[model samples]
Target: MMNDESLICEETANFTLGNTFYRSQSKITRDLGVLAAKIYKSEQGRLRVLDAMTGCGVRSIRYYLESDADFIWSNDSNPENKAVIEYNLGFILQKNKGKITYKNANNIFFECFNNKDYYDFVDVDAFGSPNPYLSTVLWATKINGLIYVTCTDGRTGTGHLPENCLQNYGSYGRSHPAAQEQVLRLIIGSSLQEAATMGLGIEPIFAYFSGSTYRVMLRLLPKINLSLDNYGFLGYCHHCGEYTTISYKQLGKVNCYHQQENKYYNYTISGAMWLGNLHNKEYLKTMKNLAISLKWSTVSDLLSIMIHESNFPPYFYTLGEIGRRGKLDIPKRSQLIEALENDGFQATNTHINSQAIKTNASLKQCIEISEKLINNSKVGKIND
Candidate 1:
């Protein structure tokens, strides 16, 4: 068993994390970095961001240190974490001469500013799930602004185990890779649907998965339609595991049932577009580039495995090779075999698409190999 103290140190040393954050190394940080770089280059409007659960203040610090955001507010439920965040923010303020605030508050319902129109970006990074904090996060974000959310409860959201999708997001069944991807979509969709019920409109522009966490960065657009029925759930076939997405347009609060058993199943429909694969090429590229640029070798390797092992088509390549016109150099089949063996992976190569490729390797093996590569590279070590 991993000692709690050791795990905490591992996380802090590796990611410069503070206690109270859910995960040690967050993919949300990398995604935010990419988003920040893009927004900084654009130089559109003065950006105000809120790190809702500012455990260790890593996310807030990244935004303040790397992004062009004018003002950042970091908050946490724990007073200790709040103090740590304040200490970190003090350094940032001294260095950048910027405005940053640290607060101890339960973000589930905390009102940070008297003006409801204060924040442009609100990031919700929670331990288990982001569901409980949805309403407050939506209220905090300005209309047409970006809202970034990270859900750490992969087991429940990704359909790895039996979870009531309807109860969670007022949506239907889940998909495999699709379930994992759509989990965030449904969360965001449910939030928007709830807001619309109160005569508000928000459209999701971008969403993706990073490591164990699934993130959605959305743009709250102009209020076009205000109706709760705009979003609904989906039901999955328990037997075949086929996706059956139902929307408010089609099914209105109908209980999801299994056809074979002829019994009401604990399932409900979710987002309008919940029936699809999770891997988005553009988003994957952006994430990969950001991970590499950050020198996060472990993240880069894990992302490579996700892309290679996932159902993504062969046309997709790593960011390093994307858009380069050339005959793809097929590495010697022995190279993969040797690498797998060296990394303690029980893997073998098979011919697919007339090219030698590795197959049938367990996810555990892939992770071990990735970790080995990262440890050897030592490119991702951060200051404590």
Candidate 2:
């Protein structure tokens, strides 16, 4: 009964999703993207964007309406979506503010490069691995421009598929308690590696995980930023539940200190991934201020957590892991964080995992602290 004449409309933020593929759950990411784009525009004095996977053209509409993008090029491979995209972005198209194209994403990127039409911002909302566009998108991105790349392939990135991880991220992935966080780091590291191939570097503007999806916004630099310290591996001890950074030179030396009698343990090393700060604190602070000005309380709160956990290690320990390792009941996340903080260990909640904590303290230290807190609670109850 449905035909091309049938009109379908949905609303998100300030735009209408016109008969195109739309996911309501992805609105938060679009919101964050709009905020980041607005901030980029304010600082650079102009904003031209290339939405490589425009879908229903919602993002293009938001970029134009919310971020005040000077120009936007929205592309989707499905020619059938052209009418919907145009319908959604009609106003912008009529005003010469944007263009719509039906072409493969890589073809679009190649075209941009061939025509020397670089964008100040490029958003690639890729399904599964973002590896395909990781290197190609840079060709369309201006130096110091922002690239918002996304990956929904949790299985591959989380180490459930080692072969796929290597093929996609160019790194080994291993399943661990903190594998979700590892997905974010893998994307950043892979992006860095791709950029380095072009004699360019990237700085992490922000790294975000929205439950199942992993996203990282990076600023392309004119120089290469790949080095031993920042581009490295992570060694997680299966025996003791500890995490440590491993450089390229230290690959053969990855031995866990958690020795049993005379037996030294080997760590499950996962990397050739990013070991750098996940978010730029100053930039996140600026984003938070913008969120505050807009009265977006939820966004502000999330940004606050991201800023706090930015300086911690690349991995986090879930309360479940701490409990299992200690042979005790799962400690309350809030109480554990409080105890860790009081004991001079910098511990905070990670937005990546609600039940986890990012801290400078070791897993053993965390377990010990949890025991003391639980015991103290018992003693207080007895006295009462």
* Whole-model Cα lDDT of every candidate shown, in order: 0.52, 0.89
Off by over 4 Å in 2: 1-19
Kindly list the per-residue Cα lDDT of model 1 for residues 1-384, writing each as its tens digit: 222243233222222344554453564454444454346334455677777766766666667556656676766766755545555566656766444444433433356534554577777766667767666666676766666767777666555544565566655434442455556556666667666665666654345455576766665656745343434455543333233445556665555455577876544333443222223345445656767886867656545554443342111112112112222333334454566677664444221112233333432344344445545445546431
Ten contiguous residues with the weakest lDDT in model 2: 7-16
The numbered model that scores best in lDDT is: 2
Q: Candidate 2, residue 268: CA error in Å?
A: 0.5
- Name the candidate that leads on TM-score: 2
lDDT of 2 by residue, 25-64 (tens): 8777887898899999999999999999998887888888
Candidate 1, position 112, lDDT: 50
